[model samples]
Target chain A: MRKTKTALLIAASTTMPALLLSACGQTPTQGAASPSSGVVTITWYAGPITGTGVRSTLISKFEKSHPNIRVKLISAPTSTNTDRANLTAEISGGASTPDVFNGDVIWPAQFGHAHLALDLSHHLPKSFFNRFAPGLAAGASYKGQEYGAPLFMDAGFLYYRKDLLAKAHLPVPKTWSQLYQDSRILQQKKLVRYGYVWEGNSYEGLTCDWMEFMTDAGGKIFSNASLTHSVIDSAASLKALTFMRKLITSGVSPSSVTTFEEPQAMAVFDAGNSAFLRNWDYAWSNSNDPKVSKVVGKVGVAPLPTFSQSQYPGYSNIGGWDIYVNPHSQHISQDLTFIRWMTGTQAQTILATKYSEIPTNYAVQKNPAVRRVNPVLNIVSKVRLVPRPSGTPSYPKISQAIYTNINSALTGSISPTAALKKAQTQIDRAVSSNSL
Target chain B: MGTPNPLEPELTNHASRPEKKSPGIRRRLARQGWAFALPALTIIAAITIFPILYSIIVSLNHITFTSQGYHFHWVGLHNYSVIFSNPLYRYSLFFTVIYTVVTVFIELVAGLLIALVLDKLIAGRGLMLAVLLLPWSLITVISAEMWNYIYNGVYGVLNALLIGIGILHTPVVWLGRPLIAIVSMMFADIWKTTPFVAIILLAGLQMIPHELYEAAEIDGANGSARFWRITFPLLRPTIALSVLFRVLQAFGIFDLPFVLTQGGPGHATESLALLGWQVMFQDLNMGRGAAIAASTTLIVLFASLLVLRAFRAQVGEEDLG
Candidate 1:
C-alpha cells in the first residue's frame, strides 16, 4: 500500500503542470471577445483624489456619451506608498485588465524607465504642454520622454483659523518668524494647544512639506538634475530646520507633530485645537464641512511662508498623480481611446467643476464653469511645482534618507546640522550606487 | 533464511499480481493524492517561498523601480554592507530585539497568572475562559485604533479619568514622548496578546493530573508549595512553547505599530520588520528591502532553534526526573 501511495504521488505531481498549462491558454480568448462586440472596456485604477462620488459620476457620464464602451474603476489606497506598490505590481504582472493607471507625477519617470508605460509625448499637443505650470510637464517626463498625462496637481499651503487670529489681534503671518510669534501669543492666551500642525512623519508627505521650507530658505536638494551630491546641508537649509525645531521646543507646535502624518495632523487642526495647519488644498473643502470640522467657515488659506527676504519666491512642492496607458497592454488601441476620452476637454471640465480636480489641460483651466465651481483653483494656478531630487532610479532611497534624518532632528535625537550632514552623506552614497 | 524465502515468494507473487491491476486504478489513486496536496503546495510556493527566493536573488543585485521594468546591476554584497554600516538599520535591530524580549517576558508571566486563576474549580469557569479569550480573537488593526483613541492626549479616556480623579492635573501625550510611546505600544500589544498565552497555559493546567497535587498535599504541602512542586515542572514545556510563539509573533509585528504610531515619535518604536517594509514598499528598493528581510529571517530562525532546543532539554530533564 505504501509503495502504491508513493507511486501515486509521483504520478500526480508530474501530470499537474500539463493541466495548468492548458488552463492558462483559455484566458486570453475570453478577454479578446469582449472588445470585438462594438464594446470597448476601459479599466481605470485611481485614488479618490477628490470627493468620493465625483470620479464615479464622471465615468458614468463618459459611458453615457459612448454607450458601447464600459468603464471599470478601481480605487488606489489612500497611502502613497501602497498606491505605488499596487501600480507597480499591476504593471509588472502585465495584466492589461487595468487599461489605464493613475500615476504619481514622480512615478512616471520610474515607470517610464521600466518601459511599463506608453510614450504620450506625440499624443499630447505642444499647446497642451505650454498651458501647464512651468515644471509640471517636466515632472511627468523621464529622460525627455512623456509617459503620463497630468490630471490634477497639488501644492502645500497654510490654513489658519480666522477666528483665532482675529481674537489674538494678529494679521496673516507672511514669514515663519511672524507665524511663530503669533503662535506663541495664541498659546499664551490658551486659545489653542498648538501653533502649527503639519506632516512631520518620516513619509512622503513630510518630504513634500520639508521641500517647501527648504525652497523658502534658498536651498535645493540637488544643484542640477544629476544628483551627484546633496545641497541640503547648506546654511539656508540648516536655518530652516532650526526654525522648525524651535517651533516644537518653544511650545509653538507640539512635539507630537514629529509623528503627525497628513490625516493625523489634519484631524488635530480640524478639531479646532490648532491655530494653523500646513496642508494641501483639499483640506479647504474638508475643513469647511460643518459635519466633520469644528472650525467650519472659520478657516483661511494662504501661501506657505518663507524665511529669507532675498530668496526666490516661496514655493510649494507639487503633488498628485497622472493617468497613463500601459505599454504592454494587449488592448493598446482601446486603452489609448480611454486615455484620450478621460483627459479630453469635456471630461476635464466635468472633473474640475464637479470633483475639484485641477485640470492639466490649459484650456480647461480657464473654463468659466471650472472657475465658478472651485475658487481654490486660483491658488492652484499660481502655485509652483517642484520635482524631487534623485529623479533617476534612486528617488525612493534618497527620499527615505532625507526623511529619516529630518525625523531624527524633529525628535531631538539629532541636531539639525548633523541630521543634514548625515542625510547628505547617505544620499550621496545612495546616488552613487544606484545612478546609471 | 526459511522466513525470508517465504516472504520473498509472497513478495514476488504480489509483484506479479500488480500486472493484473487496472492502470485506471493507479491513475485514480495518483489523481487523488495530487488533488489533496496540490492546492496547499501551490499556495505555499506562490505566496511564501517564491517571494522569499525572489527577494534573495534581488538583494544580491541593484534593482530599481522605473517606467520600463526593474533596472538591475551586479552589486554583489554591496547592499548588505550598506545596511550593516548604516546607523538607522542598527538602531532598528536593537529596538526590535528589545521589543521582542520585553513583550514576550511580560506576556508569559501575566498569562501564567491568569491561567492559574482560571484553573481553580471556581464557579463560572467556562464563562471566565471565554471572557479571557476575547482580546486574543480581536483584529489587531481594530485593537490598535481603539488604543489610539484611549491614548489620545486631548480627549483620551486615560487622561480624562486620571485628571478627573486628581491623579494628574494635565493630559499626558501618551504617544508623543519617545519613551512613553514605546511603553504605550507595549501596553497595547500585551493587552491583545496576553489572552493568547492564557489559553495555551490553561490547556497545560488542565493536562496536569489531579493525583499529583493530591499526593503533594498529602505530604503536608500548602497550595503554593504543591503548585511549585507538582504543577510547575510539567508546565515548563508549555510555557516555553508559548514564549517561543509570542517572541516570533512580536518579532515580525507591523500592523499594530504602523496603525498606532507608525514607528514614530522618530523611530522609537521601529522594528526590524517595519524597517524592512519601509525599505521594500515605501522606498521601492526591493534589493535593500530583501536584504533586510533575509537578515530578519535568519535571526528569527536562529532564535527559534535555540528556544526549541531549550524546550527539548527541559522535556528530557522532566522525563529523567
Candidate 2:
C-alpha cells in the first residue's frame, strides 16, 4: 500500500507541471533547420467545401507525383473576411497554422502588408509567372513582388436574351450608350418585362458593379502610384453614379434591384423576367442547364459594356481567388511546391474539367475542351479586369465606404458628388489611421 | 471592485462586537473567509469579470495584430469621441431604441390578450399552447430563412397571396423599401417571440386566486372592472419583469436582420450589436469596437435601473425579484 501511494505521488508531481505548461506552449523559432522527417506535411486551408473540390483530385495526383511531400486539408468559413480573421488569430497565437491557404483577390495586399504571405518572386521565374493571364497575375502582386499564385479566374458577363435582341434587330452593345439605347428599345417593343437587371444591393456586389463603371470612365481611386492622394472625388465617378441611377429612373432596370445581390438577380432572370442580366460566368453553366432554367439555349453572353471614352471596351472587375504561403509555416519549401503544382497547367485542366473552374493558366483556358464546357470563357477573356485598391490593409474598410456611399447615392439620399466627397473623406481617415 | 465598500460600517455595527479581543478575532475570521472563497472568486473573475474589464481597457487603446503581432498604444477617450461623433453610430442607436420600445409595448399587450383568451377556453387549451409555442421553439436561422423565402420578390407566397386576395394590384417589393423592410423584419421577430411573452403572462394569470373573481362578481362587479381591479394589479410584477428582459433582448437582436436583410436598404434596420460586431470582427477595428460594446453595457444598465425605478413607483418595494 505504501509503495502504491508513493508511486501515485511521484506520478502526480511529474505530470502536474506539464499539464499546466501546455497553456502557453513554446514559441516556434523562425528559420530553424528543416525537419528531417521521412515525409513533409503541408496543411492546406480552403473555404468550406464538403466533397471532392479542385484541391482533392489535385492533391491526390500531386502526392503520387511528389512522394516526399504529404498534404493535409482543413476547412475554413466560406466567407473571405472570416477566413482572414481566423488566419490572423491563429498566426498571432504563435502556434500551428496552415502552410498554404486560399485568399480572395483583395487579400494579397492586406496579407502582404501584414507580412503573413511569402513573396513568390524569389521562387518562380518571371517567364513561369507570365503563364497565368496578365490581368490575373497583377492581382497577386504587391509592390512589384508576386505574393500569390492565381488558382482560378472569374469575370462578370453581360448575359442577354439572344432571341429578344434578334427580334428587335439590335446588335450587341459595345458601349454603355448603346446598351441603354437597346434596353429602351427592347422595353418599348415589350420584348421582356424589364430591359436589364444587375446587383445594386448595399453589399460587396455593389462594389464590383461600381468599380466596373468607375474604371470604364477612366476614374481611379488614388491619384499617385505611391497611393498618397485621394482623388476619387471626380466628375468621372459622378458620371458613373448618374448612369447607375438612370438605369432605374429611366425604367430600364426595376426599382426592386435595390435589394438584389448576385443570386437575387439570377433568380429573376432565370424566371424569364428580364432581357439582360449582368452576372459572373458561373451563371452560364447554371442558366444553360435545362433542369433549372427557362432560358436554356436562348442565352447569349458578352463582356460588360464600357464608356465610349474608355481606351479598352467592356472592362469588368477582376474576380478570382489566389493561393499564398504563410511565412510562419516551417514547411516553406513544401508549401511552394504544392502551390506551383496546383497552379500548373495539368492541375488547372483537371479543375476546369471536374469543377468547371475558369482556368487561370493561359494555356488551360485556351484548351478546346474547356471552351466547349464553358462557352462564355472566351468572351470573359476579352474584357479588361481592373482590380480595386487591395494593396492597403484598409481595403475592406475602403470597400465598405465605397459601397455604402454608392448605395446612398443610388437611393437618392445624397447626390453623387456629395457621396464621392463623403467616401473620399472616409478613405483618407482610414489611410491616416495608425492601426488597421 | 477593490474600492471601499459602502456597507462596511453597517456590517461591523450589525455584528455588535465590542470585546477587547474582537478586532484580532474578526481579522482572523475575515482571512479565513477570504481563503475559503478564493477559488470560486478566482474562477468567477477569470470567466466573467475579466473579459468585461479587459474590453474596457481595450476600448481605451488602439490595438491590432500584424505579422509582428499585437501592437498597442494608448488613445485615451479618442475611440469614444470618434464613435459618438460618427452619424452611423447615432443612427444605429436610434433605430435600436425604437425597435426595443415598440416591440416591448406590442408584445406585452398582445401577450396579455393571448393569456386571457387561453385562460377562459373550455377545451384544446393544451393544443393551442403547443401550437403557439412552435414558433418560439424553432431555430432562429431556419425561421429567418423561411421568412426570407416567404418575402422573396420573385416567387414569394406573400405577394402571391396578396395579389390573389385583390389587395395588391401587382406584386409589392417587401424587403426593398426602407420603412417596409424594417417593419417586415419586425413582423418576423413578433411571430417568433410573442409566444414567449404569452407563456410568462399565462403563468402569472394561473397564480391569481379564483375566489377573488367570484367575490367581485357577487358584489355586482362586471368582467372589465374585476380585470382592472384584481387581475391587472396582480399581474403588474410579472409584466414589469417581462418588459425589463424583453427590452434588453430586443436591444441586442442580431440574427434576424443579419440573415434577413443584412441591415440593408441603406442600414435601415441595423442594431447597435450588429454595428459593434462588424467593427470588432469584420473590420478588425478592435478599440472602437470594444468602445461600442462597453457603451452598450452602460446603456443597458441605465435602462434596467430606470425600469426598476418605474416599477417601484407603481407597485412599492416588494419581492419583484
Candidate 3:
C-alpha cells in the first residue's frame, strides 16, 4: 500500500507541470479578450520616444482602444546596451517587469540561451507571422523558434554622387573593381577627394561592413547555417579584405576610414568629399535633409556593389529592430496582443510614414507613402538581405574577432591574409569553446 | 597667533583623557564607540562589503550569466589564467599601465612646477588658483567631449589653426591613429586634472616652514638648492598621500577614455576599467569580468603600497639618518 501510494505521488508530481502548462497555453489563446479579465499594467521596454510621434500616436491609439491594458513604456537611448542590461538584470533577478521589449536586430541569438524571451511561434498565429518580410521573420527567429516580430527594418545602401558619376561619364559602379576604378578616375579629375568611404572602426559597425564585403565576395562566416563550424578563413574573404586594404593604401579611401563610423562616413560623403559611401538607408533621407546635407538632390542610391552582378545586386546587411515578449512577464497574453497590435498594418503605416520607420511588413514596405518619404525603399524593396554573423550564443565574441582583425588590416597593423587567418582561429575557438 | 586645527574634532577628548585610564572604563568607552558607529558600519557593509564578497564567490566559478541564472562549470584559477594568456587582455593591461604611469608622471611634474610658480608669486595666487581650477571643476565628460571636437579631423579648430599657422600642410586625423589618440587623450586628461595635482602640491608647499628657506639663503644656497634640500625633503608625507590618491584614481580611470576616444582607432586606449565593463555587461561574461576586477584591485593595491614604501624610504633618508 505504501509503495503504491509513493508511485502515485511520483507520477502526479512528474506530469503536474506539463498538464498545468497545456491548460495555461489554451486559456490564453482561446480567451484572449475575456471580458472578465481586469486591468493589467504591462511594461514595454523600448527606445526613447522621439519627437516625431511615431511611438506616441500608436501608444495613445492603443490605450484609447484597450481600456483595460496599460502599457508602461520604459524608455532608453537608441544604439546603447543600457536598456538591454536593465532588462537582463531585472529578468535574471526573476522580476516580472517589462512584459514587452524592443530588441536589436542581432539580439535574438543572445536572448535565446537566456530563455528570457517567450517563444512567439507557440502563441502568435502563422497568418500574422507571414505578413512580415521573410528576411525579418527569419532574422527574429532563433533556432527555428520565433521570439518576436520585426518592428521596422533598414538595409545597407551604396550612396554615391549622381552628378559626379554623370559628369565623369560613368554608370554607378556595379562591382567592387568598378567602384575602385571609378573612384580613382573621379579623384584624379579633382571631382572628389576620395573614391570610396565606409565604416572601418574596430567596433560593431566594422563587423557589419565586413559582413557586407564578405557576402558580396561570396564568403560566409561559417560553413553551415547552424553556425557550428567557423570556415571564415576563405579565399573570397581574403580578396575582400585585400580589396578594402587597397582602397585605403591605394588612396582611394582616406586613411581615416579606419576611424569612421556611420555618421562620420555619412558626413564625409554628404560633404561632397567622397565619390561613394557605404551606409544604411538613413543616409538617403539625411542626404536630402536641407538642414544637414550639402548634396541635396545630387545623391544617388544603389545597392552595395558585389564581385559580379549575375549573383544579385550586392547584399544589403539587415538593419532593424524587433519587439519581444518577456518570459517572466505576468501578462503574456496582453503583451502578445500589444505586439500584434503594435506591429499591425495601420500602426506600422503610421510609424513608417511619420517617423521614417522602414516597416518590416511586406505590405507596408510597398506602401506608396513610405516609398515617397524614403526613396531608397524603391531600390531596397528587392535587394538581397544578408543576416549578420549570428545564430550562436557567442555572436558578440565572433563579431569582435572579425571587426578587430579586419580593423588591424585596415590600419596596417597586420596583413589582410594574417588578419583573416587570425580572425578564423579566434572565431573557431570562440564557437567550439562557447558550446557545451 | 596660534590656532587649533579645525580638522581634529576629537581634540577635546584626547587632551582630557588620562593615559592611565581604567580597563572597565576603556571597555565601556569602546562599547559606546561601537554604538555610535553601528549605523555607518551596517550601511558600509551593505553598499560595498557584500558586493565584494559576492564577486569573490562569482570569480571562483564559471558563470554563464543567463536569465535563468548562472550555470557554474567550477573552474578555479582558470579564469585568471585565461586573462593572463589572452593577448587582448594583456594589450589592454599594457596600455593601462602606460596611461597611468605617463599621465601621473606628467601631472606630477607639471603640478609641481605650477605650484612652485604660485609659491614665488606671493600675490594674485588666489586668482591664479581659481583660474587653474576652472577646468577641473567642469565635468570630465564635458571636457573630454570638448577635446574630441578639438581632435576632430575636418571641422576642428586645432586642424584649422595648425594649417593656418603652416604647422601642418595637410590635416592629420588626431583621433584616427592609435598612438596619436592615446597622446590626445593624455593631453585632455592633463588639461583637466593637472590643476587638482597642483592644488595638492601647493598645500604641501605651504606646510613647509619659511624659516628653512631663509636659513638656506643665509647659508649662501641658491633657489634650486633650497627647493631640493628644504622643500622636497619636508613635503614627503603630503606628496606621498597625494600620489597615492592620484595613482588609485588614474589606475581605475574610465570616463575620459570612454568619452574621448572610446579606446578606439583600434583598441589603442582600452583601459582595464573599460575592459572590465565590456566583459561583464557587453559580453555578459560576469565570471571573467569579476576576475578582471579582482586583478585590477590587486594592481592598485600593489601600486599604492610601492609608492608608500618609496616615500617612506625618502622620508627615512633625511629624518632617520
Best by TM-score: 3
Let me know the DockQ for model 2: 0.15
lDDT of 3 by residue, A18-137 (tens): 121212221221112333558877777778433334566788889898998877776755654545555655655556666788888788877766776788988878888888876678
Candidate 1 runs further than 4 Å off: A1-33, A122-131, A308-313, A383-385, A434-436, B1-55, B61-79, B153-155, B167-170, B314-321
Worst 10 residues of 1 chain A by lDDT: A14-23
lDDT of 1 at A136: 68
Candidate 3 error regions (>4 Å): A1-39, A48-53, A81-83, A434-436, B1-27, B65-68, B71-73, B313-321
Query: How does each model score on TM-score?
Result: 0.85, 0.84, 0.88
Interface alpha-carbon RMSD, every candidate: 9.7, 12.4, 16.4
Residue A172, candidate 3: how far off, in angstroms? 2.0
lDDT of 3 by residue, B57-78 (tens): 6667787645455677788987
Per-residue lDDT of model 1, residues A1-436, tens digit only: 3322332233222211212221232232223337557887767777787667867887888888878777788877777776766655556544565677887777876677666678888665665566554566787888888888777777788899999999989998878888999999999999998899988876777788888888778788987767776788899899889988898888787776776778778898999989999988778888888878998989998877768544423678888778888665666666666667766788888777766667777778877767887766777765555656736756876787778788879878788999899888878876775421
Docking class of 2: incorrect
Give the distance in Å from residue A135's predicted Cα in candidate 1 to where it truly belongs: 2.7
**Docking quality (DockQ) of candidate 3:** 0.10
Rank by TM-score (best first) = 3, 1, 2
The Cα local distance difference test for each model comes to: 0.74, 0.76, 0.76
